[model samples]
Target: MSVRKILVPLAGRAEDVEVLTTALSVSRAFEAQLVVLFTRPDPTEALPYLGDGVSGQVIEDLMQAAREGADQASGRVKSALTKIAGDAGVPLAEKGGEVKLPSVRFLDVTGRRDEVVAAHSRLSDLIVFGEGTTGVAGGTALEAAMMSAGRPVLIAPQKSWNPVGGSVCIGWDDSAEAAHAVTAAIPFLEEAKKVTILCVGGKELDPGPGSTLADYLELHGVVADVHLVDAAGRAAGEVLLEQAEAAKTDLLVMGGYSHSRLREFIIGGVTQHIRSHATIPVLMAH
Candidate 1:
């Protein structure tokens, strides 16, 4: 199960270059089409603040500035993505296959990030976005797409990254959401040479579930290792992260269990923690 199309939401911020690079790499590996989308605030929505008394000159000037800023950001994002694709030796269609780059397309959209990402996700096989700090709104687009588009999301950190290598660590909880996430992530796990089913808490809570998942993966020709962590004093998210780091896993696949409205995520402490501070990219489904 390889991805055939990927939607990457770019903010044109410097921090997003790594995400763009990661997306391109994945696109090349899977021979998928890459769609880079830049989102801008809708100007019409701001018109309510400009009263009828406002001078035409002022309005024109503001609009021009907005347009210029949007153009500049869009250009930067395009250039960065193009360069990454070129370095990877993937062919760019517009270049007539002379320049190696992925089949890339750029879309500049105005309005809300969530809406734009959700629309693209509906047309794509996967959504990729950058992960930021805890309080800050990092990976908001990815989260929104997951909830609204009913697709899987890949959240990459803001540093240099490599396509997932080695083993994939799966956080197993035996819930319906977890099952869905596992199924959605089968593409990645099948590609990975190794996989681990990690369970937190005691057998009294749930014991054999993780083993069953591991066995299922083994049947698919994926080498799987199952382990249980006590998660006593430490947070579940922290424990998971620590285990992943120790195992040197390249990717973490987990279910996103949420209790609150889609507007904001009200998730378990572990989920929130991993969403806020995981070093490696996370592939999540709800």
Candidate 2:
């Protein structure tokens, strides 16, 4: 399937530019429309938390402040969007309009941020997320998108980049999640100049070998090289990232949250490690 529309959620954080740049690169590659969404937390959410001693005026003032903060952030996000899209030569347009060029649109909404992001993601072909500020909000949005959207999510790198999807790497483990990821990444795989399937640790190949995946990709007219890596007591995620870097991969495709999120958080799994520390773009599916 082709990526026709890309959704990028911006929180007016420091990483907004990096995220927008990454999304625009992919949009250019696929000639897709980019939807830059700005979701603001509902100011009334703080009302229930006000203590008994809090006066009505104080509560009203707090809500006003929250609203002002959200408005300021929205302005900053829109300014950045205008500058980036112009620099990339992508025109801005409205939703449901006929267009002949690679275009972008801005969507501003107020609600629970994660819920709003998840709802919008359901209508898009792909979702792009930045490594947001360290906290629960970013992780919540990611989980919501993966679980609720049923769409591929592309995690932008730590830095801005162009010409993504040129060289690709797939992290295979023979699990259903990994297989789903491979299917979701068909658009990128079919277009990449180089594709590598890296199976880290012999254990993951027992159920379905890397060759099997290679053969599957061949059916889609994608020629891939399979490499079996020996983890040798090192973290599998570390090994996978190192190999991908060595291969000069621009995009890495893999399953996310293959195990339960709780288990991964407690014991540390490949998905967690990569999510926490990848230098390149990652395309993931659940």
Candidate 3:
């Protein structure tokens, strides 16, 4: 699918710069609209969680503090967005309209950050996130975006690069999840100058996995080079990372594997490892 609208959630933290830069790179590639979502925590939402024993004065104080925190965060986030847009030569606006490539808008909303981001992301073509965003609150947003929004999520590394999706790499495992990821990444593949399909431990499959994927991409006018690598008892993530880095890939497209336990979703080990260690942007879908 074409990526026309990209969503990036910011909490006014230092990492927002890297995330914004990475998102902008992608926006430039697709000439897409970058929506910077800043969700302020609703002070009133915490009142019920505080319970009835809290005195009126204490509740007021807590609410005031929450409001102050949100205000400070909003200021920082806006300032950072302005500076980044200026440096990248991208236009910043409060409203969307006819604009140049890599245009951005700051969206301010009050509510639960994760829920708000997920709700807004439903309409977006892609969601971009920082690698460090896999933490508690960020992890909640990531999970919601994948499970609820059902959109492709791009995890940007701490460091930012230009011309994202210029050189694309795909991790093919002949799994349903991997197929979904490929479908979601068609736009990038179609636009990429170099495309590589890295298949790990695929020698055992009856039909060559890499050849099958190559044929599929050919149908889309995307010529892909297939590389078969032996895991050699190494973790799949480790091997994939090594190959991608060797190729100097700008984007890595792969499946996000997860399972439920005790009513909670846990990211698969390989996916988690790549998120934590990859130095380039990773596009994933569960």
- Which pairs of residues have clashing backbones in candidate 1? 90-100, 90-101, 91-101
Better of 1 and 2 by lDDT: 2
* lDDT, candidate 1, 37-107, per-residue tens: 89987766777899999888988888888878888888888888778877776655653344333478778
Model 2 worst lDDT window (10 residues) = 201-210
Candidate 3 segments whose C-alpha is farther than 4 A from its true place = 94-101, 133-138, 202-207, 258-268
- Which tens-of-lDDT digit does each residue in 1-286 have in candidate 2? 8888899999888789988998998998899989999998887877788878999899889889998999999998899999999987889986577784588999999998889989999988889988877632247788788877777788886888787879999999888888888998999999999999998885444535789999999999999998888888899989999999999899999998888999988999898888888898888899
Instruction: Look at candidate 2 and tell me the lDDT of residue 61.
Output: 91
- Put down candidate 3 lDDT per residue, 73-124, tens digits, no spaces: 8888888888888987888754445665568888889988778988998999
The TM-scores, one per candidate, come to 0.89, 0.95, 0.90
Clashing pairs in 3: none
Clashes per candidate, residues 3 or more apart or on different chains:
3, 0, 0
lDDT of each candidate versus the true structure: 0.76, 0.87, 0.82
